[model samples]
Target chain A: MAITVRIPTPLRTLTGGADEVHAEGATVGAIIEQLEANHPGIKERICDDKGNVRRFVNVFLNDEDIRFLDGLQSPVKDGDTLSVVPAIAGG
Target chain B: MSGETPPWVKGALRIEAAVLRQVEADALACYPSEACGFLFGPADDPPLLDEMRREDNEADKYHRLDPETFPRTSKMYFKINELRAVRALEEGAASGRPLKVIYHSHCDAGAYFSQEDAATFASGGTLMWPCAFLVVSVIDGEVRDRKLHVHVPGTNGFRESPLTVIE
Candidate 1:
């Protein structure tokens, strides 16, 4: 399945300044693996050593948070858009 | 950097007096905890603030869900609820007024970008959005100070932006 992933500004460097990229995968985890193949060091930024999505990082499928869905295993079809959002906190 | 306006303060942000007052009031109302929200406006040379929308800090909600991992209370940090942000983005786009600023308040600290704040929003020299960040300092339930910071793009930091309040 072909999916489009919207890259946030913080991770644009990994994608060579491109704001979005296309990857092939049936699940979000597979798509992330595809992203890692295309852009080195991206998976580490999005996922931890245990392969779990970082607590501060959110993955969304078509504007719906993946955490509320099936997480990394969330299914993706052709033309689906995924967004990688970083959680920010300060006071 | 706290009170004295810097020489580079060339009026990068223009906001309405009523909106500014609302921000300060909201910050004070939240008190000991931080208040977070979005500023919607045009994507012009110097963005003009048209409206403001307050969002519930997700940190408080998540803390209620899993306190061990989300240890920090609302008093120390704020994570804008993702759902609210998405909805705001959609609605703003529909209205032709995109999000121009992300505003947050500090309980007792001065209106300045903390190290944690910079790292959280602009890690590895990349900012989440091409918008400015406004920090309001609320001390003892009073708005003590406010500052605007814009990402320096290539640099992993933000520079002070002059905020002009219009009546």
Candidate 2:
């Protein structure tokens, strides 16, 4: 299934300045892998050393956060939109 | 107080006096805990901010979940829920007024932008959002002076953009 991923600005350099891109995967993790294959260096920005979504990045699979729906293993289908939003935070 | 004094940015961040009042009130209401929100206005070179969208501070939640990763609680930090951020962005665009400023409260701290603040506003050495920042100092539940900071593109720094208030 082809999914649409909303690329945050920081990773735009990898996506050739495109704000959005299309990838194929059955799960969110698989989609990320596809993104890394296409864009390179993107997986590292979204995932940590343990492959868990970075604490500061929010991954939403069509309105619901992936963390609330089985995390990276969350199932997906065609026409789903995945948004990776960097946390607006400060200390 | 009318904004007819010094420190006007001429063509940057012209805001409504009522908006500042709302921001101050919101900061005061969220005192002892950091508050955060966005100001929306027409997509002009120097946007005239006239709308306020308050967001709940979720730093405490993150800190509680993983203190090692998020070391600061709501007392010293603030985090806008990602969902709300997305929604607000869309809402602003749909209404023809894009996000112009992001304001936050700093408890017991001054209005100077901290290193961590710069880090949060940027990603991988690039700024994510093209908006100004307003830091409101709230000490012991009392709001104090505030400062505005605008990104200095390619400099990795920010400069004060004196905010002008309108009637």
Q: What is the docking quality class of candidate 2?
A: medium
Q: How do all models score by TM-score?
A: 0.80, 0.87
Which segments of model 1 are wrong by more than 4 Å? A1-4, A12-26, A68-70, A74-81, B1-11, B66-69, B83-96
Judge candidate 1 at residue A39 and give its lDDT: 100
Comparing only chain B with the true structure, the TM-scores of all models are: 0.86, 0.87
Predicted structure with the largest DockQ when compared to the true one:
2
For model 2, the superposed segments whose C-alpha errors exceed 4 Å read: B1-11
Question: Mind giving the per-residue lDDT tens digits that candidate 1 earns over A1-91?
Answer: 9989988656777999887899999999999999999999999999989998887688889977786688899999999999887775665
lDDT of 2 by residue, B87-119 (tens): 776676667677667889898899988887887
The positional error of residue B34 in candidate 2, measured at the CA in angstroms, is 0.7
Residue A14 local lDDT, model 2: 87
Error of 2 at A55 (Å): 3.4
Error of 1 at A68 (Å): 4.2
